[model samples]
Target: MADLHRQNEHGSRNRTRFPTQPTPSAPAPELRGHGLRLRPWDAECDTDVETWLRGNSDPEFRRWNTPVKLVDGMEDARESLRLRAEWDAEGKCVSYCVTDAATGAPLGHIGVNDIDHFIRTARVGYWVLPEARGHGVATRALRLAARWAFTNLGTHRLELGHALGHDASCRIAERCGFLYEGTLRGAMFDAGRHDAFRDVHLHARLATDPEPGEGEGKGE
Candidate 1:
């Protein structure tokens, strides 16, 4: 959410590395829980591209988050997916193409991005199709991604942020166990402009933190 998500590709910082704690290089595994399935996006699949395009272009999504590279067309969406695949291959990020478990119908997108193995931290971002909203999709997707990070990657912390005033995102993050951390003034590109700026509400969830509902985590 906000600029934190789109800027993750260039967010890697120069830091000391240890052989025993080398960065991850594993395939993103598919996860299923809470009535949904989370799998990697298929850059080659036309349906995936279509969904990506529609989601990114949705007015509500654009109003909240900012992409470093905007996806305005099918080609742009495909390229974004391709790059996401490359990042997944490098273990820099793990993005999921969220879908309905029963029907396999695409619902939205979620990602555990900018993995820093030395610190065992990552950023989480997501968006649900307009038609899929109000059904707890984002919350479930987030909890699933968090569980994967904590269990699989041993991630110490997972961060989530959204432009200020995005009450819906804040609630979703909190419902998934991401506690409100603070705000970063001018932390994101303003609503529809890249030059202007805006504040972001930061939230975080630590591996040691208690899961929201323990099992299958039900919520709004």
Candidate 2:
């Protein structure tokens, strides 16, 4: 297994080959699983992405996620575009916009962050839209993303961390086959306040782990 802490600061290897320009020529590749599909983020589909983010980033969702300040209409889409651009340039991290294959509508967002090519591991983070919650969108999205990372980027392990008290997220991690390694004390701050940070549960799925079945898998 690859070291999980190695950092990839330079874009020297394992770069993803995505077209610089948005192409409507073909539908985004579908990552099919238990009744779900995960695909790369499409700026052309910004309308859907914006709608999902705007509708879901309410106080309820913000309870866990860092507060997002949106400027005007479509700012979220613009930010998504910028992040993709960074992904292209950095050659390390990648993000995807999750959607329902049957309907091609946006359901959520997931990404591999803090990627370390030398170690061939990356951290996973995700959020599902309000209406799409409890329907296994996050699990499906995470499974697909992990598979892609391991297959395409030569990743050996995927790591996930969830705040303490996030029972739902903890369940997701366990269901997805991640081992609860341990937690970090005061590891993260939420909502701009340094609340007593709960022990973050760390979980990892190795490349040698059985190929994730085609279905909704879990990661917090």
Candidate 3:
């Protein structure tokens, strides 16, 4: 698993500050899916943001994703928001709060990382809140973001990878039309932060690929 807490592809440490909510003159761009919405992280989302951080801090999330430097939940949430803002402003990444389309409740987060304009490629990652699990939130959010990346953001290819044991993430990637590429040996966090690397499975979707509908299995 890639480090969800890190900001840049180069693995450099940086800090970000929360910015004021977008005004009416510059409302945040909205990305919609069948029953989901992806919007820029806003001030009101700190709680959900903290949830995401603390969720990933546990052994369950850490086992499959890159280990995060654990900190106080609220403190990490504040810093995560600022780091996300910095990533966006630096053109390093674009992240969004995944929400319920009708109720306007945040369910999770999804984003593109390690973006390289010259290559027109980026890596896609996401996490679903516990309550959102089994609702197909992650697959929908991922597909929505991938479509926007290819059609609107000039991304030619989007990469998705997960720890070899993360069946759910692999399923979500496949359902979103990412083709299985191969396994990367020792490519992820093993146990603790900076622990030995674990193997990872790589998948990717090209702009020319056809979209897969719901229920699609891991490999077509």
Best by lDDT: 1
> Each model's number of backbone clashes?
0, 1, 1
Over 69-155, each residue of candidate 2 has an lDDT whose tens digit, in order, gives 532357665675566546644765676677788897777778777776655668998887777788877777777777777776677
> Which runs of model 2 end up more than 4 angstroms from their true locations?
1-30, 67-73, 194-198, 211-220
Q: TM-score, each model?
A: 0.87, 0.74, 0.80
lDDT of 1 by residue, 1-220 (tens): 4576556545667644423122446568889988899998999999999999999999999999888889999999999999998988887888999999999999999998898775678999999998888788998888889998888777888999899999988888878889999999999998778899999999999989987974433333
lDDT of 3 at 11: 49
lDDT of every model, 2 decimals:
0.86, 0.67, 0.74
Residue range with the least summed lDDT across 10 consecutive positions in model 2 = 19-28
**Candidates by TM-score, descending order:** 1, 3, 2
Top-scoring candidate (TM-score): 1
Collision pairs in model 1: none
